[model samples]
Target: MSTAHDRERAWLLVTRREVVSRITDKSFLIGTVLMVAMIVGFIGFTAWQEERTDEATLGATPEAVAMAQAVADAAPQVDDKLEVRLVELDDDAAARAALEADEVDAWLHPVDGDWQLTSESSEQDSLTAATRVVVRQQVLADNAARVGSTVEELEAGSTVGTEFLRGDAERAAVAEAVGFVFVFLFYFAALVFGMQLASSVIEEKQSRIVEIIAAAIPLRHLLAGKVLGNTALALIQLLVYLAVGLVGLTFTPYKSYVPALSGPAAWFLAFFLAGFVALACLWAVAGSLASRTEDLQATSTPLTMLMLVMFFGGLSLDGRGQVIASFVPPVSAVVMPKRILAGGVDWWEPLAALGLLAAFALATVWVGERLYRRALLQTGGRVSLRQAWSAAE
Candidate 1:
């Protein structure tokens, strides 16, 4: 008689069948399309935001051209470049006419050696604020010049110098957004796929299919095939996302960011494998503990909770917290990527994390195989952990 250990063909066939079944599933197809759409939409939205910046139109009299020049010299806070389009007019009437006709965002006219600005709304925009600052500075200089003194003299030579510390924080907002996307995608996908492995195991057990399959194939092969097949699908989905994302990034000006992000991206894949397998084994264990979908909640709740903690906790880590996560299994997959995106990660962290996670994954597989062999044949009701533990392997 051919036993599961006598030959690997039966289990290999089982793995192939599972991979084909999942890849051809209608829900999987729809989910893939939706995921692609969301990622594309996100990339499009980012491109739009990068292109959109505040613009200001300034209407000024021919004599008040200095006001426009001052506005031009002051950079708007939005893009660090002031877009002050000057519409020259002969008098205040023409300027007001332009302003009322929406020809300019705001207008400036000279009155008895003083300048007055007119706008449609009380709320100030970046351009408007910049224009105000320039006008004030110019007026101060002019007042000092009238008295044969300088604006500097009036300030008593006290100038406040403010410096911006970009230091790994310059791209903070962007990094945080991208890292959130990366972490959450991995976090949610891992949980969903892990549960899928569990549900498949339970489904096969509940249908009594495992009895026939185990009779023909070793229980270990069966367990390995199920985990391998689902993991392959999960990886295909993740790679698709990464490829689409890279393509999108290439189209945008942010393509330069790819090289820096690639390391973390690679780590994400490595950790994802280790993390998924570690969790996937538990999922298999969870499935073997239950005979039906209804019975899965109690068995799988701990698995779900562990994933949730990793997801939320990974989001909260900083420098030291992230380093600590790098040594920890599963969550390290997420934490390390975030640090990479944030920049300033050490060189050895990824290697260390990957090693630790791989070790844990191997241990999990051992335990999960034992659990599967013990409980996969038990039926009719929920199989408690105690019962499965005491059952012959």
Candidate 2:
């Protein structure tokens, strides 16, 4: 009989082979580079878009320069990043020339004791609104002086202060964004790696390599090696992507979301490992049932559907349903971390959910091992789950 140490060595050799083959594959390396580029490019694009300033130049006759300046100063109150620049015009003809030459976004002058705003085409609503407010304030100040009162006194009781009953609105928005990221990463990694694991298993069988390998090492060891190896690769790739994303985020306005997301991100990785292992086992079983690559789709339909449900559920579920989903295995992998990020969950809730996921992973491994062992050597056609379960070892 093989000693425990020898069995450990045998399985470890298989694990090493799996890891080496994947890392050495040209396609995998190329895909990693492309993904990193996409992430960096996206972050750069977002930063560029955010940093761009909206500028509006207005041509004003000398007399209206002060009004234009007031509009410029007040424009930020309407939209913080808006810049209204004033260009002096000698007369109406100069203003018209400036508008025709695209030297100004609009033209402003006095008409019939009221202000007139003219543009070559449609005017920006924000600029129009800001100019209206400044004009109204100037008129109000004049009226106030006639009545021996101040604009401040007339507007003192009109300002409204905001209050949030639940939490900071900005923080809540950040949490929602973080939760969406978690859901997407989990869904993507699990589906990609799970399918890869299944394909590896079926390919080995198709080439008749598994039979020779199985004779040397226990089938359980083979199964363990494949699952653990792929899990490691999946985790490593995920961490690299997340690291790149976090580093990129530091240069964006959303960098503030980092601290808020850090805790939940860590928990997500932990839950991901357990949940991935469970799904990996099922994927292995799916592969073992297939007699060829052509049958893979037929056997893996259920797993695909499950992943879809998890994806949509993580994004759409809310209220009491969300609370209940945080305890369910697999789905909990995404939901529990989201709830934690959203706040209001007790600390024990994630711990309990992780515990349940771990247990489910263990159970899947046991059942999957039996099915894989029985169906791996069957060559003529695809094997049904019941036939695999009942087959003699």
Candidate 3:
């Protein structure tokens, strides 16, 4: 005699119970704390790396002044306080000897028309390329001055110029970061929580608790409620993690808020939610299909492969070939946002992508619920998608 509304309310109550049970668990609280700690530790590590050391050892010979002057000419921005030591090396061999003896980090030699720069692998990070640039510019400037030619004339000798056809520097950096972060987070969060969904369903089935619940509630309602409960749990965890990460970002020294939230950022946030819901529904269906926790590994393989494809596909954004990928549901949430962050996407791209993403999400959840109702109560064996679909008849 109970109405559909009554059944839905009962189902919601079950979901609420599950959510409450999970949200209050000790492991959940501990995991949240550890996540915060890791964020703080990462921040500290970056600060330490930036502030730790500044060491450079420059070696010279009879050509030391010339070489230094050339470097200075190439890059006039060199710090005046940098120490340029003079070494009276007899030849290239003597310079090599000085480097071998740790007397200098790098040796400079004036070959016939060019300078031979040598440094150990250990000195690579410390040695700035500006040293070589300054030297080259200084040499060119000196020659031009001797010929009574202007610096402008000297510059005209170099015809090559860099061009950016699409976006500016800020946009480019944002796009790169967004693409990498979006793909990584989607892949990571889906795998971690998707497995939890599968395992939870299988556990309930194995314990025979689900069979008892099915007696009072329709099998479809029971399965939908379970998926809804686990999804709520995942969303709660995701929000908490996002809040902590934002706090960490505020404390850290990142300078690009414009790209982080503007143009592509807003669009990305919209699609990411749709993408998460769609993927989560599929994960729920995956959970319902498995008969035991052990079967989850094999059953969830398809979802894992799909996630991997979406993730790796986003990596092609650099080549501007991810345009197609940006329209796909799960992939688009990550890819389109990245393109927007990078300033490569048109304003309408997000709107179009979100529309498709929403349709997919709705369809997936609808189908997932139907499958759950049909397969959840089936005992002693796993239910294939084909079997679950046919059960409606």
By descending lDDT, how would the candidates be arranged? 2, 1, 3
**Candidate 2 TM-score, true structure as reference:** 0.86
Off by over 4 Å in 2: 1-5, 60-66, 88-100, 107-160, 165-167, 254-257
In candidate 2, what are the lDDT values of residues 333-371, reduced to their tens digit?
Answer: 899988998887888999999999899889989999999
Model 3: lDDT to the true structure: 0.69
Q: Write the per-residue lDDT of candidate 1 for residues 1-393, one digit (tens) a residue.
A: 885465577667767887999899999999999999999998999887777766678877888887786776565543364466777788878877887788877777767876777787654467667766787888899889999999878998588875634344436665787788778888878778887888888888888988988777788888888888887888889989988988898877678776766767787888888888888889899999998898889998988888888888788877677778757877787887777777666688778878988999999898788887998898968888788878986
For all candidates in order, the CA lDDT equals 0.80, 0.88, 0.69
Q: lDDT, candidate 3, residue 22? A: 75
Could you tell which candidate, 2 or 3, scores higher by TM-score?
2
> Per-prediction RMSD in angstroms?
4.0, 3.1, 3.8
TM-score ranking from best to worst?
A: 2, 3, 1
Give all TM-scores, in the order shown: 0.82, 0.86, 0.82
True lDDT of residue 322, candidate 2: 94
